[model samples]
Target: MGSKQSVLQENGYTVMSEQHNTIMLKNKDGDQFIIKKLKADQNEASDFLQKLNHPHIVHHKEIIKDGDCLYLVMELCEGGDVSQKIKQTATFSEILDWTVKICMALKHLHDQQILHKNLQPKSLFFTACGTIRLGEFGVIHEWSSGAQITNPEALSYIAPEILKGEPYDEKS
Candidate 1:
């Protein structure tokens, strides 16, 4: 087995920037991608990302477990995330367009019995073509017997039932 950095290099990916657990990589062809280092408790989330595949959702390309840390390679959205767009003063039409696309992505996730517990502006990304792509599944949970609260990092984004320590279904 090779080191994580070596493996990525051997696969033709060069590190462009790294911040905390997320690394931005660029292949020899200049195509960019992101690699998220998953903590031990986030194993299930990695699996969920692999199982999820929708045009509006960020695509999980591969999973590489290097020693204690698990890394997930995902499609990169060159157009940046929703928060950046909002900071730039997005137009009303652009906001409406993003809203519909976000709803579509959420509906798809709900249909798959998955809950995106963290649905803040930062979680929504845009491709180079301006298409919305939902990412950040750090708090994803299976909707079995309703979803369970995974973490309190995004308390404001959490459902009321979850904050109350009550079971939260997809509707919540």
Candidate 2:
């Protein structure tokens, strides 16, 4: 968390932007990486990163720990997410375009048997060329039928069955 100074890299080091609990690295190849610290027993996070790989999802480049803080080096979405972009543009078409792309990404995940339980505007990244991509599937999962209940974050996108305290079909 110092003024853009040279930081550690593979075999060498590079200068990066330092945030509160995260660091943004500008790799020698001109690629930007957002590294953040991880809490203890983050096996779920580690598993999600290893299991899921999609074009719409942000890439997990590396995982490092400088001292006690664990760093998850991920591809930095330069233009920010859909919500941030929409805040600047009040047009319906812009919102539609972003939603379509985001929905497509969601459908893709569903096809892979993965549910992105947290599907908020902030989690949908937007590009300059008007594209919406999903990010942060750390809490994503492929649950089996007739499973026990848990995870309150998923309640927002819950289906009718779940609302009625019935077994939830994640694919639905």
Candidate 3:
């Protein structure tokens, strides 16, 4: 959209939150979404997300272009992210439950030959109903058979092999 104000009015969505380049919106139906604006040329991540489908993954609605910017509309997770939950004192059972959910999401991604290079608490979100869903595909990568990729920016959550400057497979 050209401007956040105009886009909100045109789409019938109210602003829930706003960031420098992104805004969270909610429609009259109570459906929530996150709209992110990026340079027109930066469509790789949005394109990839559009083709992805999984219960534990945030869903992509559509992409719209206004001038030189591309806007990505995606499902919103209202219960917040794992980082907030981690800050609270959680029971062992609760931790195990969340772990299992996250593992299932990772398994689904692997099945699709996708690698979530950044797998931290911030990337893990909770739905309004309390189900864990994986979000933030900004650093995702698709791998062909036997292909390896190098990524060292994830820090503590990154695999050691990546930090060592070695090409690592999806499992890394």
Candidate 4:
């Protein structure tokens, strides 16, 4: 939406520790940017956000700290979330375009050893030019030791092995 001033005014109060909400802000030069505050102690989120380098994935600009709030500034996407466009497409071609983006995002995450426990349509924020970006790292879960991931994710996307009362490790 709106400019940095408006977004900050509305969302600034919630921009504190444990707040996962994303906001819009501007730099010293008046350049608009997107900022998502990751949870403190979430090393996996910090690591993933730092290593991300895909075009389809949101750009990882830099980490900033304002008092106690930790912010991750990223490239802004203007198409809004893909969930907003699904209902308007009456043609197969248009639908395919969105599908391709969704797949690309998944592929990018998997390739990077990161898994999004919440991979819903709403997570796919689209751009004005139809580019799709995978975000919302608050749902991202990964292994701290780079070992096999046997932990259950958010039940919605939890692996079958993890749902069967099997042994799972959070640091997998």
Candidate 5:
């Protein structure tokens, strides 16, 4: 479980796999989690997770820091992302169910004044029990009033007004 520079071993999580800067781990109780080492000092995602409590949102267990790496311990979605699930054969009811779940999650986020700037197929994950959960809050923004923010990294999912560089509210 010891990588060249990872401290997951000290935290009681066994390394399952490593990809680039992220590692998948599982604890002794058989609970799996994903650990992502951030390259910068950012707490937006952690803050959002801590403030949110919904069934359709991915859960954040804890955050660990070892030297320069910031490891985010999150619930492991065994069913993977929705994009992969959509590519497979599914019933109409199943599709509708997933859509409703996503809408519920979005409504919750919006009610909290949190905008998921990066809304895409990859950001939608499914838990082991097949519950849809919205994830990937790296580009989430907290909005109030008519404030506008820019997200060049989320070009694919960015709204039209945002792409046009227009100052828009949370609806955009």
Candidate 6:
């Protein structure tokens, strides 16, 4: 409705950092959040993210449409992503716990006939409370029983069938 800065400020959020299309924000109450700007062409992915509701998934608080861009407001994960965590003293127990959490999230998405076409260590974020959450859902797609959905841009972490341009279901 307004300039992205003014709109976020009016909603009690102040920009903390920004890189590319992603902006980190903080409210007066000390709650942190992330806002990812999606171009008009990525509306389907944006719409898919808005419908997700899961404890292990980055919560989509709201969507702000500013001109041709869609800003997705979501909870902040201060603990960084699994990639960074792996570099630290990642204990066996921690790895096992994270694995279970990730599986749970994947199961949730698969059960809904949705496929997270881009799943990787960097996509798994950790909150300040150390809770794992699935993020970076730029290539998620709603799949039918026999429909083929593939994201050529996402080469890594994608199934072989997707890379081969073959029809793929949730299993892929």
Q: Rate the local accuracy (lDDT) of all candidates.
A: 0.84, 0.62, 0.78, 0.62, 0.78, 0.84
lDDT of 1 by residue, 104-164 (tens): 8899999888888888888999999988999988778887534455555567787788778
Candidate 1 wrongly placed segments (more than 4 Å): 145-153
TM-score of 3: 0.82
The residue-by-residue lDDT of candidate 6 on 53-167, one tens digit each, is 8989999988877788878899988899999999999999999999998889889988877888788888899999899999998777777423233444556677888768778
What's each prediction's TM-score?
Answer: 0.87, 0.67, 0.82, 0.68, 0.84, 0.87
Question: Candidate 2 — number of clashing residue pairs?
Answer: 0
Candidate 4 lDDT score at position 132: 77
Instruction: At residue 48, give the lDDT of candidate 6.
Output: 72
Worst ten in a row by lDDT for model 2: 2-11
TM value for model 6: 0.87
Which regions of candidate 5 deviate over 4 angstroms?
1-6, 144-154
Q: Report the lDDT tens digits of candidate 5 across residue range 45-125.
A: 566776788999988888876656668888988898978999999789998999999899989998988888778888899
Number of clashing residue pairs, candidate 6: 0
> Listing every candidate in turn, what is its Cα RMSD in Å to the true structure after a full C-alpha superposition?
2.4, 5.1, 3.4, 7.1, 3.5, 2.9
Candidate 1 weakest ten by summed lDDT: 144-153
lDDT of 4 by residue, 1-172 (tens): 4543444545433222222367766655555677776555654477677788876777778765544455677777778886687777537886687678767777777777666655566667766676778766665756333223333444555555455645444322
